[model samples]
Target: MSGTPDGQGLAPRTTPPSITQRHTALGIEGPGAPLADYRAAFQAARLAMAVVNRDGLVLDANPALGALLGTDPARLADRSAADLAGLREDPAQWAAYLAVLRGERPRMRCTRPLPPVAGAPRWAEISVERTADGRGVLLCLTDVTERADLQARLRHLEMHDPVTRLPNRSLFFERLAGALEQAGRARGGARIGLCYLDLDGFKAVNDTLGHRVGDRLLGAVAGRLTECAAPGGHLVARLGGDEFALLVEDSRGTDQLCELAERVLAALQRPFDLGGQRMSLSASIGLVERPAAETHATWLMQAADTTLYWAKADGRARWTLFDPERNAHRMTRQALSSTLRPALERGEFVLDYQPLVGLVDGVVHGVEALVRWQHPQFGRLSPNRFISLAEENGAIVPLGRWVLEAACRQGRRWQLAHPANPLVVSVNVAVRQVWDSDLVADVAAILARTGLPPRLLQLELTESAVMGSAGRPLEALQQLSDMGVAIAIDDFGTGYSNLAYLSRLPVSTLKLDGSFVRGFRAGEQPNPADQTIVEALVELAHRLGLTVTAECVESAEQADRLARIGCDTGQGWFYSRPVSADRVSALVGGYAPAPAVGSG
Candidate 1:
């Protein structure tokens, strides 16, 4: 022992040996032998281990513990475990550790972060178990930082899309479901919306420019979308292959959704430059906004998908809002379209003719043959209900052929019945029949097969159809006209008043559109402007050596005005609504022709 009172000490001061060394100094007796064996085992163990007294102080530690802490075993002794592990830096963590050491917890386990012993900070799973001998607590620490980091990376990859790094379909659906659940709790007035967008003509890019350029385009699009403003905690996701979706939670209303859609569309308007190629792109968006409580995620997505199809159909690069009523009507139209081909095969269609009377003498000069669908379910559907459908599905080619054959056959029947006065039959021709079909060949075949003279067959085309004609369409019309068939422009005055083309085409007559005819009523004063336009049109037709036919003359006043204006032929309810072939025969049989303005 050393003492410092006023002079020199009996022996120089020296640090005492550690507890384990002191235990070795004493002989291995009854209880001391087990303690000595435990000391040897603790020193030989590979994992980090420590013994902590009730005060949270480290009473002893092994070599592994010293290595884990980046300090020597002697330096670790008598230091608090919390201090060595760095938990004492946080007051709440320190308090929780103290509580576990006070016997308040049966067995405590936690993950603690330690200061940077290496370049990066480390993590350890620290577990405390009460010693069986009731001396103190034994601490066990396992390094799990690498595993935790790997798990985090795996989670990120699972939730995000690889191409755009946006939320994947699964994660988008998950967040959508969560938003719906939150909306359900709002009781009422909680609106949510979704904008489903598809890049228009995107496949053409991949086909012509290669998929790599397409991929670059998609990435540029994604970057722009991410930069777009998304209100109310909205999120954007890539739904695979040129499709993307935006989820707007707590949407204000349809106005907000529309605004978002507009913004999205506007974003795509800017041209994209990739691989030194400047390309312009547009998108079609389907917007669906509704009470989240009343709709599920699947239903909302379905509505958006259905509406997106509509947007594409109506013409790409537009937005379409979901309308239940409009959708129902479209469904009905689809059903009707599905049944049309079979109806044609079953011979469920019939021809109805309306007389074109001479305005000078009220005698039937010609008749217009209009197709009627004698649908078994719908009874009798007009061409208005199904003609556009046939055109859209490419069925118009076959359907138009059938009409031509039937009308020509009927014209032959009329010619045979009235050998003295044969009447011309005007058949409406669809734009698709003119452009997508071998119209000249079809008409020639029908005319020869039915043995009907070409001069007696008039094909009526809409003004817009004829006005837009060029290249193949113009050549086709010229061929048909050269075959002695009469070509007439129907629905005149409603479309491009292209007078220059009128003289250049093979057209022989102009059937002024019904809208203009309806303007000049029988008893009322005609609209001066309409009257002037009609007068000017009739004069123009005459100067061009083309007959002028006024359609939809509903009263004597209209007929007289039409006759006064030198319209050679007039047809409408005033003459009679569309009638059967027998009615046309009767009208033609009991009529007389007289000289009118240019009829002579």
Candidate 2:
């Protein structure tokens, strides 16, 4: 009667007759008529009207009822009311239908389902009345199930994710409270275990394939999740934007909880065959198994959320359980993030330069400018300690600008000191540092402020930072390269390895990851495996006309192997660890070492 019936499977409204219209519609010649006459009038009304005996047997049914029940009037009288109507399928539906019959004495309207007149289901509004004569009751049923069902469906849609069709935030909490009580009465359980999962890299798919495809992918994921819970009575819910939660019953220990987490991880390993895009993404699950000591759903959810943050922070596509030490780390992270904005304002960030030596020449050809924080309270903090926190809290944008300026200024300083043996300063760029901020403007500003020659500044970005760049990021990188600022893909081979896309990026160098470089020293002699990997990487870069710099070169033997394998430059303790600007400057100014060339 109030809201529009959304076009879901539901009933439509039946027009009720006005007082004067009711007399005309039903043709009631009332005045002093016996109650049987009044009962007969109700039974004869245009709407489907019926009266049933208390034992739930059909006593009377009218012509309109025949249309609703998919039967002729002659056959309708022979069938039981519940059988012909849809009440036979669901017991609850049948019970509600019977409550309207017998002694019920008033106008009541409801969209009760009925068997099809043709092949379609009938939604009917059933109203009943008690006669004064008390001989029998007269019932009125008008079909409005369509409108009612639509209303119910609309309510469901409001509280559920369309992709997952699962209970969302509001509905999840509502169900969780009930589950907690049932879990509270467990035979010998300690506490409940809640696993929260957020898919890593889902946004890139959304951006690349558009929201329509993204929604379909989410639906596919939801189907898999429902199957994941089919084995056990776990309650899985979608908490929006690729985040899902599972509430496991009778979960007591970390082992039990982790078992479910592993199932989730394995289930997701299957490819999502999302149309043509053979996308393979993974999730980070955070586990918090409640102890007997804990209380309340709020605290339980907080534990799950905290653990989930660690999963993403430690590394994505993995799971981490809540531990006391993890809590300490989280608190420390929050404290650090709180100060980042103010730190930028107070100029608390500084740059330290580590030399990137040419492995063949044994010369410091470039210095990677690394950001460090001299926190007022936390003492000195490395970027590893606080950079991720800064990125998560949106402080990376301004903080990154400061680092770019400081690194460029330092490179300009070293360039002025040694004009002949000029050096390039490489700076690590965070993913967030490029998403919203204008890379070209930021680099141009730094170069302008520091008066650093364009070649002196080398921007180092990770593979994840560049793989998804298409529009603005692509254009920005091109602008910076055109402006003479060199770009290098830092941490090569450690990200979404779309090799077909690598050559198209506007960059001049690739830094072989330290992991592969360190593998060289794993055996008694230079690891032939590591040596071979380096050679392959060097050849790839050489073919692309991009210089290769192998990282973490520690010994002369290692350096010799790298150079023989075609590595032109290397950065490690062998060249120098990240050092003070003054120390780096001195080394760059008067250093002389012959280029190491020749087959090993």
Highest TM-score: give the candidate number.
Answer: 1
Off by over 4 Å in 2: 1-322, 496-499, 526-529, 592-599
Summarize candidate 1's per-residue lDDT along 179-266 as a digit string, tens digits.
9998888787798898999999999999998888888899999888877744455798999999999888888899988988888899
Q: TM-score of each candidate? A: 0.63, 0.51
| Segments in model 1 whose C-alpha atoms lie over 4 Å from true places | 1-152, 177-192, 197-231, 240-243, 249-285, 291-298, 306-320, 332-340, 374-380, 467-479, 500-504, 527-529, 591-600
lDDT of 2 by residue, 337-368 (tens): 89899988998888888888767656778888
Compare the candidates by lDDT and give the number of the best one.
1
lDDT of 2 at 470: 93
Clashing pairs in 2: 10-145, 10-146, 11-145, 11-146, 11-147, 12-147, 124-143, 125-142, 360-596, 361-595
lDDT of 1 at 553: 80
Looking at model 1, residue 117 earns an lDDT score of 61
